[model samples]
Target: MKKIAMTVFLSTAMILTLPISSHAGHANHQPQESKELLYQDMLMLFLLPHIDQAVHDFYAKQLTASPVVYPYQVEVKKAERVGGSRSFHFLITLETTPVVGPHIPVGTDRLRFEIDPTLPGQVKLIQFEHLKSHELPPRWRHMIRRPEAIR
Candidate 1:
């Protein structure tokens, strides 16, 4: 009789602990779904541009001229939707060549671009701060015109 009572008690404890363990496993996975949703929203709103092909081609030429300073990868760090516009803050990592001495590699020129959805394919280079450009890339300079300059 004692043995039966001991087995029942152990089974009940194991069943109760199983749910707690399962819940913890589920909690860790929930955030991944939310992040994926956010990424989808960003792609739909900000990155769905046909003109990106031209932009990529332009960047390629610019990088060839100044490989050490030009950004190798442009990653959208954050995308926020506001009214009819979406603000995309990008992190541009400029790939620096390996130094001969004890020089450490560094990245500069982080750019933020704000695009208005209402204007269709119109993208405003809202803020180009933190950049030290001697001359704007020919493709971008010729393609994207400044809002202020438009008469």
Candidate 2:
């Protein structure tokens, strides 16, 4: 719980300071973001609340000998705004390193989400796919996704 709170706090702090940081070079003039950049920023803001949950879910399924380390890594490979629309497609890699055992990476995941441009907070997952499987943990409830569903 503390970890989650800290993660959320740090993320929020980073976001809150973003505008301040950007103004270092042009203190007198307000910066304008490009269309693509704006879309990307919005997409990220929408994803922030869900990020911790996504990481938790990934680790839950990974199963490990110990309480797999908290705060796994997430790499954003792609964040597409979907043709000037509110819909977005994301490719992310979530990895974990065990504290006392071999690591069982969660591999990459592809996600698609649709949101009302006006209300980016309300997001619906259009698609969610784990790129590949990982090693089973001490007692992972192995569940195999259908081959047809993988793609």
Candidate 3:
């Protein structure tokens, strides 16, 4: 009888505290994590459009049309929340090279992008400099088509 009473009391106490502890944790850090994820989203949004521009600037005067830019690397310069507001911003640079029959170009480009979630992002071409390169095996290259490309 004593053992049963003790067990029941402990279970009741634990059940009662479950929500309070959960609420405490949620109240403390969950919102911050959400804000961090918002910054991450801002980073992605800032990166997408600048990629083609990077390719264009890298191959300027070389290719009459914009070649497919293979984004070899991504660098996030800044990602943070706006001052006392629900806005976010990201400054990012994308390293890219033109597709030249699997040969690396003379140098790659660093395309800088800045985005204010309050407004549309803008594009800028920073530079073209030679960076060391390595090759990686195709992870998902098997999903291939002959003439056309997948978006």
Best by TM-score: 3
lDDT of 2 by residue, 1-151 (tens): 9999999999999998886444356557767769966765564655645654554465454432223333334334544554576544333332333222344443445555555445455565555566664444544423323323322
TM-score of decoy 1: 0.29
RMSD of 1: 13.3
Model 3 segments beyond 4 Å from truth? 1-46, 75-86, 121-151
Ranking by lDDT: 3, 2, 1
- List ranges where model 1 is wrong by over 4 Å: 1-72, 84-106, 131-151
* RMSD of each predicted structure: 13.3, 19.9, 11.3
lDDT of 2 at 64: 29
**What 10-residue stretch in candidate 1 is worst by lDDT?**
92-101
TM-score for all models, in order of appearance: 0.29, 0.35, 0.39
Runs of candidate 2 with Cα error greater than 4 angstroms are 1-35, 64-105, 117-121, 133-151
The 10-residue segment of model 3 with minimum total lDDT is 142-151
Q: Write the per-residue lDDT of candidate 3 for residues 15-122, one digit (tens) a residue.
A: 988854343444445434587567655655556556666555544544333445442334444444435466455445555554443443423445555556455344
Residue 18, model 3: Cα distance from true site in angstroms: 51
**Candidate 3 lDDT (Cα, 0 to 1):** 0.48
